[model samples]
Target chain A: MQMSPGSRKTLLRQVPTVVWVLLGMILFFARFAPAFFTLKNAVNLLTQGSILMILCMGVIVVKITGGIELSVGAVMTLAGMVMAWALAYAKLPIPVALLLSLIVGGLCGLLNGFFVTKMDIPSFIATLGTQGIAAGISLGMNNGNVIWGLPASIGYLGNGTFLHLPVPMWLSVLAFLCSFTLLNFTPFGVYVYALGGNEQALVLTGKPAWWYKTLVYVYAGLMAGLAAIVITGRNMCAQPTVGLGMEFEAFSAVVLGGSFAAGRGTAIGTVIGVLFILILRNGLNVMGIPTYIQLAIIGPVLIGAIVLSVLVEGGAQK
Target chain B: MTLKSFLLRFSRLLALVLLSMVVAVLNPNFLKISNLINIVRQASPQIIISAGMTIVLLTGGIDLSIGSVVTLASIIAGYVLTQTKLHWSIAIVSALGSGLLCGLVSGILVAKVKLPSAIATYGMLWVGRGLAFAIMGAFPYFGFPNAFRYIGRGILLGIPVPIWIMVAVALVVYLFLKYTTLGKSIYAVGANPYAAKASGLRVDRILIYTYMLSGLLAALGGIILTARLNAVDQDIGAPFLLPAIASPVMGGTSMTGGRGGIGGTIIGTLIMTVLVNAMNLLRISSLWQQFAIGLVVVLAVWLDMWIKKKTA
Candidate 1:
């Protein structure tokens, strides 16, 4: 099992540059920001980052199929709004309300899939349309106001401790497992990669590529729905705009994870990617940097890291 | 134009007419001349922005940063106009110049660095928005000189200046796409990049120019928006991104590139403007506006696809 020096070098090169950037960031933040490395802060970061982690799990599924899932943020918002409405107005039990949110999210995903596969619209545009629809419905449902009066019991799902870990952390891990298993251990997973890498081959094999493509969007929608439950439970209310711009963050995390092109990404890679973003943002927060300034820095860092990976690792070349 | 091309071009017009009829029936006030002018004026900046989007779309790319570019360019202009002692005209130059620069960077990212359009432009969106936020920093800029305001507010030949600007922009873009070698190359490149490159057309250069044009036009739209509002803030341009994208696609411009034009975009803009106007006049909750627009975008694009299929 001894590897040659050249082969080892190539193996090392296959590692995305984000790993190093992530290490550097950790060291830099730990030295400069005294509060960055605390156990408490780590818990807080995981709690906050769980929603992003969940969303990224969904986004990577679609990205691997060469489709962008822009509607997840809005879909999550709509799902939360529905759940909140069911809780506050309909007086439904917590479980029913939660199930409703997932259904709503899946329905939105179905619409996106229909637009993309059946209507032949580009994924971004189709998803953008769904974003508008979902966002609009969320806003219109509550007249652009926050919905309050959720059952106290629901908050336990979002904020309560589970085996000394935050509930959100557990839920996010569960989501990661779902995405990981679905992407790695199933015939569907292979078809998903083939959909992006070589659709003609998939079609030639008598596989229904369009159906798998549609399922990718649907999977993303389900994740958004799950995120909605956590966010709603945590806040104890649903704000129509709570999920705003979340899709962009999820997309960035997936791309940052080394899914630079279709058919090239891993669940492990996405976890690192999520951690990279979570750490950067959390570190900046610990350092007391203004939100606006942090935004300016993150943009350059994101693009630079991706470019470095592409150039240095020669990863994901067409 | 052949009857087929004529129908292809004016199908959106028919939709616009039918939509106006519905709105006019529901609210007769919507049909008033003043209100109609108001709609177009309000839509002017959108039309300009969508024109830029249409050009980029024609070249088989998307520019998500146009909204951010709008915010940054106008803020730059506002900073120049209010904070500096420079002539008011300098504000215009600064706005357009900054916009062009943002587009150039995006172009290099997409055309040369070979990043995906969605990712490159999405990054630019953040940078532009962040820069705008940094520059403004918890305070908005206002109180531009009257000369600057005139572009948005003043009347020209019984019409608002914004309307005139919109028309002029449409005409110039229409002509450019029709006659200019570079403009034609944009279509060629979008239709098939490999073929375009093999045929000695500089696909990369065309992509850069298309993005640059989109940026410049977005800045121009921002200038008008700033003039009308008489102020500038970081959030001013955020909402325009969706409609800017929806309009050209609704106008029958293919999202996949190489088959739509400014002519279709203008009609699409009118349809959206009228829809919004109808909603406002009908006293529907403004919250539903986003939903309606989103529905229209999906339906419009769906309709476009259906028509394309039928024709093919």
Candidate 2:
């Protein structure tokens, strides 16, 4: 029997939930198939997923504006390097170093925003250019050397526990709460969705859509900076290669979470998406699969997720 | 040509000349013919790839998978040569065939599957790179026949054979773009897909062809790169991808589509090659080279936008 359009729409909407269920199955199997399933492993998964989740949050914001930020990974690297320089070489306090890194990231984002809005460049090309610049700066900062000997206090954010969970995991939760509220409760958030939905219409309505669009990029940059801080804390060192290929990870998470290509996403969906990927990787590691095999899986899975989402969303519309 | 068109055509040329003068001043050896030939030789792979990329950009699409395609193509050729008794010519054909296959897949994804070009191609990038790694098992392939090396590193009457191949490819593409009905249709499609469709142009067909051409060219570049390096590795074309994209954009090809040509791309390639050569001559750290390239890309786009504004 042919399904009605209404039924098809409802069925398609369950696709993401089905994906989550599949992930749950994997988690359950991972528990039984190997000795890798324990409270400690779960905490490790959460902690590792936290920084990536934060990065995915920023990516979601920009993607919601119908733009992509390819430079976030590089910006994260740059921010880490800058923070490391401030803390290790300049002898700055941890708080000041962290603040400076965030500012640097924000400025990088602002430049990306300016290029997209004022300069009328495509987001992909602009960010691609900036990615090179940020990577270069990261390498040039310490001549590609890893900066070690960060103050012990800096480790608190990355290694500390709060309420029996990692501090970074808690921070990710806070970040998600803030993002959800900002997206749902604020006028600016509405503008962001509208901006992605029909930018020309907003422009015709006499609204400065460019400002909001640019702000989205700025926010993404700031989040990258925060992610850098967390990563540096966790590793206790800052290296030029930190955050390599992270943009792809975040992009995959955002897409897998049902964020439309033309912009539309949710913090909760992204959390599930990030957790799904983290669990998959963690499981692969436990199973002793080579890293290249993991890459092979990720590439197809990302493409499949995007294709499925497009198909389902299109069906819903019809 | 009108003054406006003249400026559009020669802006990159002017930049190239200006850059050449600065490099010459920095080091007198830069003006020597041998050094100049060396620059063109180094730029051959980029030039070949950028020709196809220009066409893709002109159609308002992108092919981010070219880098991975190059690696894969090289690996395929390398595997055939090393593992099979196939002649080098057969290996070359297979390498080119692999690239064409990749391009065809990407074309179908973008045109038939109705996926965004960027998203589809980006996905292909990962798949292709993964396949390259899988095939080679993280090892580099060497020991190719000397005849195979001739395509990339042979000298023909005191000039590199790759430079000759690059010039020929550029000539063919220039002619195709200038004198063919399909070429004009590509421009029409890039200018306005809806209008092109309404006017009886096969928009999807043209898009597919463009991406296929991009893939083919990327494969050709892969072959050349493998020959030049005399080895095949997983990272064969990783560095060329950015420069391939950047060259066409720097050449004043509108990323939004329908406004560029092969001539501008040549100048862009020259400028980039010369710039890198100058950096090496100056003993500048390679870390800063990426920064310089990024700065140049942004500035070039910014300048292009300014010119468009002034003309408007």
Candidate 3:
């Protein structure tokens, strides 16, 4: 029974399936464990996954465009601060504040895209350079202060619920839907997959490749902006450091979703990945696992998944 | 030469100078000799780490294990210094040896096993951090000899000890990059793997040495940092990894591969280190400092585009 090639391949595939199984185990625990099954914990997991989902979507988009965006987390932090400032300090209306936040995000995203696409700079280096810039702007703008005191309406996104789901969770679902639609339903989406699959070939197609590449970044930026809204709402406050190390988490999620780091992505897979991480983290917290050990667990899971992806696709990759 | 290429290069050089000038003018204290020394000393570790990182980058690889290796090495060094009767010199070797071992593992995973560098290092990051945590508990190490502090704190007449070490490392890396066969092979490998393989270079061997060097430098940095504080913590190397890569990128390392230098990275590190310390000294709130770093990273990345557009 063990000698069959089909079973061997399935076994190899099942190696990576362990992470998905872990998700199932966590879901089971959430169902049976009194502490884990509480409404509060359920809502907690939802809100947590909300921000992670939003950030992960952007990462997926950037990855799909055949580039990495390491600065999404940094930009998210900056936008969060800006959104908070506009509502609290600038004393703007909610709509205006949202617009300003979106604009900031879009501009940052545009700059990053422009650098990588137009200037022929590598996306990783370019985004990293911008990560510092985003941090600096946040610091200079606020002098390292936290943003607070937003009107209750703007605060609704963080804690509000509809149909029993947390607001962030709803937003995450919306973002996921939008990404799926954009990637699958539109010609521009077609262009993106083609772009990632082969940049030079796409260029030879006589299209304005830069514009297509740039648009995904802007879209990613918009997603980050939305994430900031939910994140700020959840905390009812925003700080420059709010999103620190977030990009890596998002990147890890994207990778775990069975997406290639060299830039192939699927929205559905990424959503599963994001959910898997959210559940894993929340479940661990509920289990009284130490934070350090929790991080250690993530490491093994990431490696195992990646190794599984490589091994399963090794022959097919060529 | 093409006008676009020349102008692009010129603009990069000018951006480097102007950035320094802006910082200097904004704070006259930034221009002082003491501040200059401080900047170099601060950048020493990052500059060293970036040297090896640049090589890895050239080969289209990343090393997340840097943070972990540093943590492991510093702890090993710290434990030897505090708990054992072994001399400091031997302790240094033991510490650096551990870092090399981690780096070697990552390299083998990447080069031989053909695992992505990012994934391999990510695993090492955890394992290494876990080892550090297991050894040090939750508290910072404080029982080291003051003499060990000399590596971080001593000055040669007017210059800081760390600054001298930085200079020596920079010169050595530069020479290696410019003249050595292995170094040239690294560039060749990065520039075109197929071509290099056809030309009879062992790409894996080059990659292994490159990452090993990165690990060694990062470990050295952790030891210096721990010595400076007279304590080692698990958190030390973790935060520095991004900045390590960021400085080199800002200095114009082509993230794609085969385009950058130790000179540019050194300058970039100096600018960032000084800026960070100055912010701290000025007592800018932590939030603002984080915001500022984010903004600076974005702008530096954007600068390439702005310059290219201008040239176009």
Candidate 4:
């Protein structure tokens, strides 16, 4: 697995500017805030960030197909609601409830795919519609109340640690690996890139571009489903609004991970992007910055990072 | 307009009327004059916001920041009117100014920096919301001066002031889009940006201007909403975002841009407003409203696309 020195140097040169930003941020936070550079904080940050990390993995797949998946957050919430309902009301076993959550998430994704492929709706609007539907169902499931009283075993999925790592972290890493393998090691990955880069060309190649595109959405939904289980297990309850606004954070993460445009992201790059946001958020929190100010800062920082990446990329081309 | 085009155009209005008939039949009170005025008044700010959204959509760009722009603008105005000794006009100017500034930045990101419109504006959404939250903090602003509240609450000649403002906005937007070179340029840019640039149109400027207009209108809508509620909170503008996009698309304004107008947006707004009214009258759970609105948005766009495909 060892890389030759020359190949390693070229690989280093190809890294995005955001990596530098991330490194600089780490140094800045470590120096300015003594509390931020600890092992405990690092674990805490990743644990807190695991759900978003998982969601971004799914979103990146859809992004590769030149589609923005806005429904993931709501889909996650809906899935959690379904899971909670199964556990508390339907008296289902923990495994059955978890499976039901994944099923719900996949169904929502299928709905989004149907809208985009069959109806020719734009991804954002189609997903926005799905967002409403999912959020609505989540709200309506228990008359907008939070579901509680899960069996004790359910907590292990969210709170337990495995091999000296948090359970959610394990799940997130699993998601990351799955996404990476699916995109890089399979023929489907080629079609996904083609779907984003030149959909018509892919269609003309005698491939079923429509089905692949639909599968991309369904894949995203399944990830949301996975994230939902973690989030629900973490809280031991499912509020209808639990996944509110996570989609934007995941989208931002994917974009910041060097996918400036569609058809151009990698799992390693996505990991970097997730770390960048995690550090920004964790650093700001460690500094005792107000939540509102942190929000104000994140937006400009996101835009600035992308702009910097674009400039660097352009400069490299020249 | 030719007979076919005329029928195609009026058919939306016909559908609105038929929907009203159905609602009226269910509730019987839906046909009352007072109830009708209430619906128009309730729909006023939405129509204004959607009118702005129609302009952006006409340019083949979407502004995800308008909802936040609405919140930011109203919070600015509320702060000005509630905390300062400034005239209400000054407050209005500042609100509009804040929106314009936001739109300008979003436009620069999309046009000059070459970012996607959705991403650029979506970033602005958080920036705007964060600023609003930072300014307002935990306290909601309430109890505006009568002079300012008059815009939202006043009834002139037996019609609510918002309805009047809505009409004014729609009329001005309609005339501007139909008659002005810049308006035509917006359409040209949306239809085909490369062609527009080759034809010597200032595509970037038109985009910036369209976004600016949208921001301004969103501010105005926010102002009316604030005045009506006499309160400004952090999430006040969030609910309006989806409907603003939906109304225009539902009104026969194409999502692809360059093919819709303010007239259709008004009808679209009416249809949407009536649907909500029907839901309320029917006692459908308030919890299901978001689902219904979301479904309507999807169905509207699907129908629009279907009709276009068949026509093509």
The model with the greatest TM-score is 1
Chain B of model 3: TM-score? 0.92
Off by over 4 Å in 2: A1-38, A315-318, B1-5
Give all candidate RMSDs, comma-separated: 2.0, 2.7, 4.2, 2.7
lDDT of 3 by residue, B84-133 (tens): 89998877898889888888988887888677687777767767777777
Please write out the lDDT profile of model 2 over residues B1-312, one tens digit for every residue: 999987866778888999999999989999999999999999999999888889999999888888889989999989988888989999899999988888998898888878778778887888888788777785688989899999998999889999999999999999999899999888888999999999999888898999989999999999998888888988788777878888888888888899998988888888888988999999989988888888888888788888878877
Best-fitting candidate, scored by DockQ: 1
Error of 2 at B104 (Å): 1.2
* Candidate 1, superposed: residue stretches over 4 Å from native: A1-8, B1-6
Considering DockQ, which of the candidate structures 1 and 4 is the better prediction for this target?
1
- Backbone N/Cα/C clashes per model: 0, 0, 32, 0
Off by over 4 Å in 4: A1-13, A315-318, B1-7
The CAPRI classification for model 4 reads as medium
Decreasing lDDT order of the candidates:
1, 4, 2, 3
Error of 3 at A211 (Å): 1.0
**Model 1, A45-79: lDDT tens per residue?**
99999999998999999999888888999999999
**Per-prediction TM-score:** 0.97, 0.94, 0.87, 0.95
The TM-score that candidate 2 achieves is 0.94
Q: Which one wins on lDDT?
A: 1
